[model samples]
Target: MSFSRRAISLCAAVTLSYGVISPAIAQAQDFNGIVDSVHTHAADDASAKMAPLGSYASGQLAESAAEIVAFHAGSKRILTVNALSGEIDVLDASNPQKPTKIGSVSAGADKEINSVTVREDGLAVAAVQQSNKVLQGEALFFDAAADDLGAAELGRVTIGALPDNVHITDDGAYALVANEGEPSNELDAAGTAYVADPAGSVSVITLPAPGTVEAATQADVRTAGFEAFDAPGALHEDIRIFGPVNHHNKPSLDLEPEYVASAKGKAFVTLQENNAIAIIDIASARVEKVVPAHIADHLQVPIDSSNKDDKAELRTIPVKGLSMPDSIHAFTSGGKTYFATANEGDAREWGVEEKDGGSGVYTDEVELADVIDNGQVCEGVLDDVEAEALGDKKVAGNLKLSNVSGWDEEKQCFDELYAYGSRSFSIYDEAGNVVFDSGSDFEEITASLNQPGVFHHNADNEDPDFDDRSDNKGPEPEALTIGHIGERTYAFIGAERVGGIFVYDVTDPANAKYQTYINNRDFTVDFDEDNYDSTKLAGDLGPEGLAFIDKQDSPNGEYLLVVGNEVSGTTTIYEVESVVEKEPSTSGSTKGSSNLSRSSLSSR
Candidate 1:
């Protein structure tokens, strides 16, 4: 089946009794139309309803998808988790453009999984935010791959803290959970999700970390890593929600959720604007440590030592450090598993990675990393390194970091960076260095450097026309995952706003190339070819997450790509064909365009 056709079937559209969750997702059902009132304790009992996909799904394919309104056996589907209205949308994209909303899981703020993921059992788990310091998001586990074909209300398991994300690994030995609590899932729901909330919760998960990895060889793309998105568990945070929400973390619960994940065992997360990536050991249910990474002062690093004049515009970007370690992929190196997040920062931040934090050290005994380039400078960013070997040093009571390092070499540069990178596909090393830094470097290369590469301090900043590496424009991929297309390696990137998927052939990291681009703006049986340019990017598809079912472990060699769009509030599924079965996709995708249309928040 074609990619678009499969994406359309992730969810089927059967009219279940009045339920919760719709585009303008409100507090209760009947949004604008005599909506029903909701009970705070009773979840899975909302009266809201989702709107039909606009004339957008107009092709014959959509008609096919409309028929599948429930989960089916043997079918690999993609599920959408909506944090705002507090619900889940399952799409049976066994057809793409004509994808159908098969089922809807209506719970309360209790079902909001900050992190949503599906596993081989055809099951998906959500970490719903809870209300306490002890617990975070609630864990809502349900059967997705099963095709009983009925309106089933799989009640959720109340996980007390905010379950940021979940992971199901290949070995299946364990499911990893990132419980980013403190304010807890139930703590603050003001900014995220189209809805509002006051608390958070987390779940319990454990995964075996792999062997060790070398710092210098961190950027090598040949290594295969593993990650899992698990379910939220039962439990509540340690704190109550009676007073005004915290204020320090504008978006967070007025608190620095040290780690996006703080579940027992292990956790790793990136703070987009915070300019940091946090790692925690849930063994004791507390943040073990934080890797505060920053960039080098490339601007100050004089390209020519003789040119004494200090260049002004040396660092093109001001927030160079990995803008946000949005999502992380952990792989074992040396003797341990190292988690690396996609640091989507700009050149200025990237350059600072090479500089030594001259004065301000978050801690006095920090192993101040020296910026590779001399004379460069930047503040508030920490040098890269995996979880520092904290032999016996415990910064906080019982909060100790693992000896393993955190990084991604695929996104690294310095002779190791891939030139023919499918821009935006980054790889961070153990020390949080850019082994393959496509996300930020791509911005710099196309804009200031006049090429696709790291943001050079330019030896001198005074020269106005030095180079613009940040000029190139393309899809701004947010979510990433590695998959197999036959025997080849593929990376599925979610371009939420632009509304399409970017497929990359990473069989050879050094020669990582773009393969296919799926158009996701509207039903595409009829689209204006004129509106195909970057600027012509059709708006409002809201693609968020991507997944492909590998029957390789099952009966059929079927592969399905599941997507959760932020705008449509729908999880779309797509069937991916292997290179052997079909040719690799050759189109550039439309990504980064915001899908900020027809959206609302439900306040409980």
Candidate 2:
């Protein structure tokens, strides 16, 4: 129990209700003068609070995480990029729920590390790549006061080809990344080839402040007005690539850039398979307007499509699609400047299944007897050989879809089958428009908070039948961030196949609300009979990335959040505290009602 007495008995102490003041002038009111007589006492004590407070794991079962960044100069480190050990790790979160680890750096053999950035005075950056069919990449840097957790390189620079995410702006001045060109699986003989097409762009990194010498180059951001965002030609022949691969003097070049969020000075990014959003600026690194990101309208937007039975259902019908986002951020609230996305949809193809018969193909699929009839094709998204070779017609539509792919073809009916992730979480306006959207409200709030065969459960299971990712992307919200905690302004998001973390209240970006849902993912253990022992798990799996910090830049003085967990490599750390409601159990006297007590700040 002693982790500082379970972190001071789980926080508790935000009580204030002074009306009948007299007991010797309310005991001469001095607990630092009642915390300096409330100047809106920490946003009225951190409105709608939060809890969790503990978790760390870092690498046990197949270590897989991609984004996370935290700093606070003298102590609270964090970093974490490890996409299967390409490396960045460095924990020691100044103990926000026992973090430890202390080091990591690698990015050498098979290098994969996908994104990290620091700059709170410790200075850092990362993106490192190679295996996304090796178009090559690199950005790596860190000099947090002359390196300790193996962090001081600052020179690899290259860039472009699977960089997938990286940022670092708040006045440290530069660093962006997002090169996601992703393709690679070479085929041919009727299957097509070229997988690294046009090599997506957005690199930047000029960061020259704190104790200089960090030159860092790479800033192309591809232009010619992006040659009209091409993307299609059968999604470049099912991700096979007959197009851009580093812009062959520019013709079509599909914009891939998947995530980068820099604040006010601009940046934004997230082209996630060309469902667009570019913005840029940051002192003229370029690309000032790309926008595109539209297509929500599934009958006024409501969705939960795991294609029919990956259950947690939400539907809404008559479709349109592509809010296809993936990890986005940019915060500010009341003083405006929004941004939040996690639509989590993506596309492109390669192939395998004993060489070209499975997991590949260039997405041209269409056939429920060519669009509809055999009982309107929904067969739990068929595929036992397309539901035993089309018995009642199966393989529905795909043609590299999502430009609003709710297919109708004169009533053949793809009516609401939209596809590719607008499964929810939005809010834009930096010209990206749409100010609020949580439609299907994360599938009716994770099926009214779990337990009906545990909504969407699939971390290799401990019961609760997997349901194969609900046919395609339900609960796939995937990473977002934003914070303020008092005087409103929340956001969070992060679902990634229904694992957890939703918290909304967007301080009125046109009414945001939905305030709670956080998971740690132990779901009764057994990812194949335990031994993965993250203290018998039950939370934090697949969250992919989110960070908050704030209690004066937090070094654990409270108001944290953290999360990382790409399928349980783990990193939890919650503690947004702020509750005080007690006095409601008086009708009878047995004493079993429990209206919530525990003081300094803590709750489940």
Highest lDDT: which candidate?
2
Q: Write the per-residue lDDT of candidate 1 for residues 261-292, one digit (tens) a residue.
A: 22224555554333455454444444333454
Scored by lDDT, model 2 comes in at 0.57
Runs in model 2 lying further than 4 Å from the true structure: 1-75, 79-124, 127-140, 145-153, 161-198, 201-252, 255-271, 274-315, 320-342, 345-420, 424-443, 446-500, 503-604
Q: How many clashes would you count in candidate 1?
A: 188
After aligning candidate 1 to the native by TM-score, how far in Å is the CA of 35 from where it should be?
Answer: 34
TM-score against native, each model: 0.47, 0.31
Q: lDDT per residue, candidate 2, 364-455, as tens digits?
A: 32333334334544444433554333222112221123322444447544544445667677888777787677665565544433333233
Q: After superposition, how far is residue 113 of candidate 1 from its true place, in Å?
A: 4.3
